[model samples]
Target: MTATVRPGLADEDLARLRARVTGPVLDPSTPTYDEVRRVWNGAVDKHPAVIVRCAEAPDVVEAIRFARRTGLPVAVRGGGHSIPGFSAIDGGLLIDLQPMKTIDVDPDQRLVTVGAGVVWAELDRATQEHGLAVTGGEVSDTGIAGLTLGGGFGWLKRTCGLACDNLLAAEVVTADGRVVGASDTENPDLLWALRGGGGNFGIVTRFTYRLHPVGPILYGGALVHPAQRTADALRFLREHASRVPDETSLMAALVVAPPAPEFPAALHGHPVVVLGAAYHGGLAEGEHALGFLREFAPPAVDLLGPIPYVALQQMVDAFTPRGLHYYVKSEWLADLPDGVVDALVDHHLARTSPLHQILLHQMGGAVSRVAPEKTAFTYRDAAFVVTVAGCWQPGDARGPHVEWARSAWRACLPGSAGGAYINHLDADEGANRIRAAYGAATYDRLIAVKAVWDPDNVFCGNHNIPPGHSGTRQR
Candidate 1:
């Protein structure tokens, strides 16, 4: 049905929109309007005029067409976890994809097909049933849409590849209200652009990925150490990471230990450096490889052991839930030098809030083998990707949390390769950062593709590139 031309969308248009989707339509007058509008990042406060919980691809198409015809801004939400709350917009139309989550696995071919709204946990559970897995977001609750769109980096990243790398194909709804499939063969150029191009090209409805034998069990978990040993731990981590097999992955976070029964009461609520290890091989080999990390001079807490991969992914999600203010900055480092370690240690010790954390994921292995130009993801050879995240209870504390995150980011900027990951970047970091994420040449190609698929910039809420007169679509 075509959109109604009446001001504020005549009641008839609302009825027509509701008729097209199986999910609920929430407006300002709806009882659950406020709840429906909330996103993962509490800091981003927006009030979209209408929220359409799309139940299928046709529902998405109808929402996009209606929003365009009405000349209203459209924001697409999958997991509601975009750092800047790009998933939702104020006084606009929100295309909520949460209700469309569905996962199907072809065990014989080792391929997994999932809807845009599927979260890491949902996909992980389904794939594991077939003794197969794919690279996914680190946290279980993270939406596959935002993560894959921005080129996912995770525990399996070094061993396999970014989530985008394993992507075999996708069904996307373009800005002009057309449905198309993108893969290495069909619409190849659009597929290339979608790899690490953010959500600028179109609204992805489903993704097909090549799966691997990951696990019901991976040998790894968090091993916490005292705050004073931060420097020593950091040095050891860097050296040990270089020697580990590609199948083994590790991540380190400097933060306060949560007050839980699993931890010693004395260490609870205190600053500590935690190491998360994941080894995708024999238990004996994993234990042997983890010996160096396990012998870290009487750790404050030692939770590292053999556990289900799905459980590990869900571990950190409990701490970083929705309705919390968050500010983040990320960088890819070629090497973690001594000076950089010192800076990280100093900042951690000086942190005024316990909510602050510095995340380091050792990158390489299968991820770097892919040619730079082969896909849209360009940061192929970096040694590590460090993310500085400040999550706090919203309200008066927001200022201090943001300030701490910003200061830490500024201090570490020089230590980086001069760019930020498009996924973790805060909304405040503007166009220059986006340009840096995709260098000059790549950015130019992305702009050219933007011209063909979305010349009018209907998908401007993401890290955007305006279309030009270039008739040839680049990338």
Candidate 2:
């Protein structure tokens, strides 16, 4: 049930807002106040004055215009996975897009059009039904909007490309409150700006990405190893990563084995070096290509084999559940130095939270082939994307978890290229980090586009690039 406005908003204002949309408007006194305030990163706690659950494209337009007219901040929420809480704004308006999730497949042209709210799991299931796939977020629960808008990464990168590379078109609501369609042919500048660029341009209503014939089931899963073997595992994986074919994409995570039925009873609550993988190839070919991985001693358990593409996508979805205190930091590594691996192993053992993890994803192959200028997404030649994530409950444990993530991230930066992935980054990185992510040239172009589309900088909560930057620096 809706609550009557009591604090900042007046009764008349609430009535006007209610008249603009058919969806429910949740204020501070709403029954589900606590639940609606929650986001993927539990570390971020924001209370938007109103949460508008949009039912149609026009509702988004109305919400944008209303927020602008009333001078209230507007946050767009799809999967609520914005680590910095791009989904929620203090004393503002939140346009919750979760209800708009829908996927329409054009099998004839190998394309899939997805609503902004659709998660990776939903999209993977839909496309895999036709023996087709598109690059998506590494975690299943990641919303299509934030991930694709910020340049999504996943198991299919080496084989196909990034999520942005597969993008065919997008239906967006600009800051000026106009609905527009963007693609290579139409609004080419806007299309280029959207690629790899975070949600600085507008609130994307729907995304249409080109698809590839991936699998109904193919070789994929994790190879778990003991914590003691972490060093060896890291070295083996890094050395072998480059030699693997484009059809094979792999990543390794240092994490504690959860106390779940899927994990070994003895290994429960203990740290493990998990080498997870997915190969878009037949069993025999995948086996032949991945033979080098077996040299690190047989895995504690080999969950690898022919599994449905959708199944592989959802494999780690449960670990990163909807509402958890999450603090993540990332850097792009051109090469994994010997000392860096040792530091990572040390940090893995030092984590107080069992949910803490460090992930190293192999990037390049087809991903690197994309031109630097074609889109706002840069760093085409980076070897890997390394993310340090701390997940825990809020309260007494918050400081320790966030500190652990920061320490791990700082320790690993010396071996990195000093660039951050917009999606995996925490708020601590701030604006300077955004500049580093998109070099001088790309950032300048993005700012010009921002001036044209969102001159007032209405979408400023993300890895923001303000309107008047001559280049990457503040000056």
Q: What TM-scores do the predictions have?
A: 0.95, 0.96
**Per-residue accuracy of model 2 over 89-187 as CA lDDT, tens digit each:** 888889988888789999999998888888888888888888999998878888988888888888888878889988889999999999999998999
Task: Report residue 392 deviation for candidate 1 (angstroms).
Answer: 1.4
Cα deviation of 109, candidate 2, in Å: 0.7
Candidate 1, residues 195-254, lDDT tens digits: the string is 999888999999999999977787788888888898888888899888989988988899
What TM-score should be assigned to candidate 2? 0.96
Error of 1 at 329 (Å): 1.0
lDDT of each: 0.84, 0.84
Per-residue error for 134 in candidate 2, Å, reads 0.8
Candidate 1 TM-score to native: 0.95
Worst 10 residues of 1 by lDDT: 466-475
Candidate 2 deviant stretches above 4 angstroms: 1-10, 470-475
N/CA/C clash count, model 2: 0
